[model samples]
Target: MTLPEKPASGAEQPTMAELAEGYASKAGLHRSSNGNIDVLKSAGGVQGIAESVLPGLVFLVAFTITRDLPVALIGSLATAAAFTIARLIQRRPLTQALAGVVGVGLSAWLANSTGKAEDFYVLGFFTNVAYILAMALSIAFRWPFAGLIFGFIRNEGLEWRKHPARMKAYKIGTWVIISVLVLRLVVQVPLYFMGEAGLAALATTRLLMGAPLYILGVWVAWLLTRPAPAPADPGTERS
Candidate 1:
């Protein structure tokens, strides 16, 4: 989680291309089915999903029932903290649990401060928008996110971009990611603008589109980037 250090003046600094390749390669190792499953388990799996969704659910339900911001915010923060504590007691990695606590805590703070329930979803809405723009820009520049990632994973360097087939595959994979993000915004943005009801809907949308959709996106990317069949040698063909 620490930021990278600056290279010394006399040292040859890594280019952005090299850094991007390294990052993509590292990311690919974690995007596989087994790797993702392990991540899910480390994150507390089904229980983790519930832990993530329940705090917001509690806030929404409490607000709907009593119309009290303090009560709702407290309920959400308390639930998130409880989940984090439970994860710690179980000796599981705290990254996911801590993230849940931080996210819920921040959302509650924003909503309470603004006296607007919709502010709870503002962070997530902006996050999705940021992702969409990043992915789109990468593809438009012909350095598609998926391609860059898998190429580095395979240690193929920038060579994949020179091949029309591989380039097309990566482009398609990047589009899959873009499509999911766009769909999320399409469904949730209007809800984000809807006031109290929108807040509730936005929370629901966030839960629905969270990890499951991400896993699906990974699967689609893998399918598109799987190794292609090698061409037959001319000498092997009948004369």
Candidate 2:
């Protein structure tokens, strides 16, 4: 009796070996040093960092000097607007600048309308809470946000979830990110309740923890998901 032949590579469903090879290659591409740099670049690099922090810094300084809410709010909003305008003029991406403007505007409105300086940080605090909730849900569903992001970056769809090892790696990475967000809330929430001095503390906390902590989390996620180095080829092995 003639035995049945196995399907050709292109005609067959991907074997475990093929899946692993593809997954490893994609993960290596995304978890490289350059990929880490891309994370910072997406956050608007040096200029983006400045755009994010400067307006808040200006507000804090103005508030400290004048102790006048309206004056401080105006200073902050003006700085945000100027950054946005500059980005527009330079033909750079407006995402960071525009986000800064909206954030500062909402913050200013809240602080001014309520006559409570601490209210300025309310939006940010709640935004963190929302992120925590979303991340928690993703983890519970076994469709981690980190995995989704990795898949999106690789343009490889959701195939990573099919591999038990990769799925676990993504789950761990997502938890790491969730931990960072939770830590922010744990530290910042108490300060938000303290009124004026608390607002100052909150602002300082935000400046200190914001981008640095985020970058650290990204690095940690990359480390967790990075593929193991491939085994050396027998032909290329050193004697």
Candidate 3:
């Protein structure tokens, strides 16, 4: 019996490379025809931004007007559901919508159980902290997560790890990302602790910082980590 055919030599890539490609794919970054990173597409574009921000915006507005937790929660859930339904109608992927639903549902549950509106933002803090620590660890390991992502997007594959300059650029990019998360906490955590009184401010900051700030931070990181163009060949004749 033929031993299971050994995988083709070209198909034999390290598992880390495979994982990094998958992670980068999910980042939604794409190169434009001119080879610039499409920051809006990376942030999911207009549809993606609306999907992420609208539910929270709805909840905040509803809570502010009615000052009723259940009503605000229901409004948020309904907004999330509406996006899910829209995706279904458009035959679009439901991953973003469904994730939004789950997040809003969890936040609603937390706030409802504790009978404090501020708890809705608590889970976000934990999530940010988790990301900060994970990215920090990746930097410490010299496997800066930004390199994994940018390398994949730039078609450099995993070779960036072998180049010290590229590795340093990616590390700085990763730190730029870490700073964004840290900024979110620094600006919002105080508002979160202010309890319901601060709910409005907390929710406002969350909306402002959610997708817009993320896009800005990622754009900056992408710029900072971009590879320098190769020097022009002196022997090449000009047209």
Candidate 4:
């Protein structure tokens, strides 16, 4: 069966297999002499970002309108529905939305039972994390020997042998953690300098801001994780 392809200019889109093989060929050009590093970039930048972010925007707008946590959550669910409807209307893929609903629901249920409400953000966070990990997991499953680890979402079938200290993955993950922490600070920093009105505005702004970050994370995920390309040779990396 044909996998989906990016739309072309005034021409029919290529099949998913075509796109996959095309990416494979493009990736083949950038191999390290030692055959360890696998570079990745996503082709579905604009479209994927839009699809991913739509739900977040809906949730944020709903939060603004509702102004109550539980009601805002219901609004978030409605936002998800709206996102699904819009995707159907546009004929975009529904896999992301469907998966988001399931993943978000599960995460919410689990967090409520075992973790604090602080553990839960909008569904965007869970959706993006799940989607991105799906890509990495795909790579890990496909090829365990490219000397690489945690292939970013594209899962370009890199050969990952363990590094001396697993330093690279640690570095990337560390930066991601730091960046998230800094962003949380950016959100909270204003509280110190704000009046009642300022605090209200700050809260509103954060409530609204989540949509874009979550969507951007989702978009990044699509890029970071794509389907693994088939191995061309016995020695070639598959993950």
Candidate 5:
């Protein structure tokens, strides 16, 4: 484990996009499957790697690089839970509720403190928030992103039979993120020795990248569920 295990510090992680892509692969009519067995399928070795650990490590990596504001880490989890509440309002999943809080908090963060209301840094803050939220949603809800692979399946990918998958993924994501955090906190080894300036650059870039990554991830998820066509009409129904 390292210092970047938490969300606030893990901006420099390279795999954030990769890991997030898995979840993003299931959007719209193609949400993550509610099959607890599938998620737990990879319980040993390869499966173990996929289910028990990798997910959290990915988050920790992002959290590690995105380091700086401890508040954002708490913000990440709080906002996620908040999103679940929002979904409950509309009868959606916890991820939807998490999205709401993310949107609000991030929109505000993006609003900027440019000494005047005139300075609307729209792209800077909100974009970053969006990216973090996309990845965070997976963490918040606890599901494995099967990408196009899972898309072929019947269930739109959403709705885990049990909420246990949510906790498993969350714990896994959080654990890995925590490990990265330990490295940064204990050894104080940064991706780059940006000192104050380098560290600042890392966070800013992460915010910038977060949006596009989210868009791509969501888009891919949709493409996977573009809707298979029905078979040709049969003559039997010609009454």
Candidate 6:
């Protein structure tokens, strides 16, 4: 009997560049047909904004009304779970919703362990510091995180590293992002120290400075580091 033909190999895995591009795309970075970065989409649109804000908002409202840490934690976690379940029912990607659930769960655990409502927000301070340090290191290493992100979004690949001007622009962009994280710590840390009395203010500022502020920072960075327009060909000029 003739030997059976070997099966074809599965599709090749994506290259690092392609993987980076995919990540940037999921991060909501996209250039419109008109060549403008879609800031609203990058901010994950309205549904995404609600996903990022609602859990904390629920916790704040619950605590404000009842002044009970356990009730507030339950409310927050429930809000996150509702979003996750809705995503599952709709057969949509679960990444953002699941992250929200995990975050809420962790915050709940911390606050429950400490018996302090403010401990719920303690995780967020560490998160901000981690991001700030990471971005700062990327800039110091001459591989600004902004370059890795925006470069892929703009399809510049790693070529931006060859040009000093491009490098300077990306470093600036990275600093802009770092600045946003720093501002969060600067404004929120004080409120966190006020303990339960500061919980309301802490939660309120966290909501205000969370996704909304980050979007603004990214928008500014995009504009600042945008590639310069190509020079017009002299031959194409009107006679």
Model 6, span 171-236: residue lDDT tens? 999999899999999999999998888878899999999988998998888889998899998888
Instruction: List the candidates ranked by TM-score, beginning with the highest.
Output: 6, 3, 2, 1, 4, 5
**Poorest 10 consecutive residues by lDDT, candidate 3:** 16-25
Better of 1 and 6 by TM-score: 6
Candidate 4 lands at a TM-score of 0.38
Better of 2 and 3 by TM-score: 3
Q: lDDT of all the models against the reference?
A: 0.77, 0.79, 0.87, 0.44, 0.38, 0.88
- Determine the backbone clash count of candidate 1: 0
TM-scores, all candidates, are: 0.73, 0.81, 0.88, 0.38, 0.26, 0.89
Per-residue alpha-carbon lDDT of model 3 for 125-192, expressed as tens digits?
99999999999999999999888778877778789999999999999999999999999999999998
Off by over 4 Å in 6: 1-21
**How much does candidate 5 score in TM-score?**
0.26
Q: Residue-wise lDDT of candidate 1 within 8-120, one digit each (tens)?
A: 88898886556644565345234334322234542346886788678888888898899898998899999989988988888876777788888888888899889998788
Q: What is the lDDT of candidate 3?
A: 0.87
lDDT of 4: 0.44
lDDT tens string, model 2, 130-170?
98899889989999988876655544468888888888888
Candidate 3, pairs of clashing residues: none
Local error of candidate 6 at residue 208 (angstroms): 0.5
Choose the strongest candidate by lDDT: 6
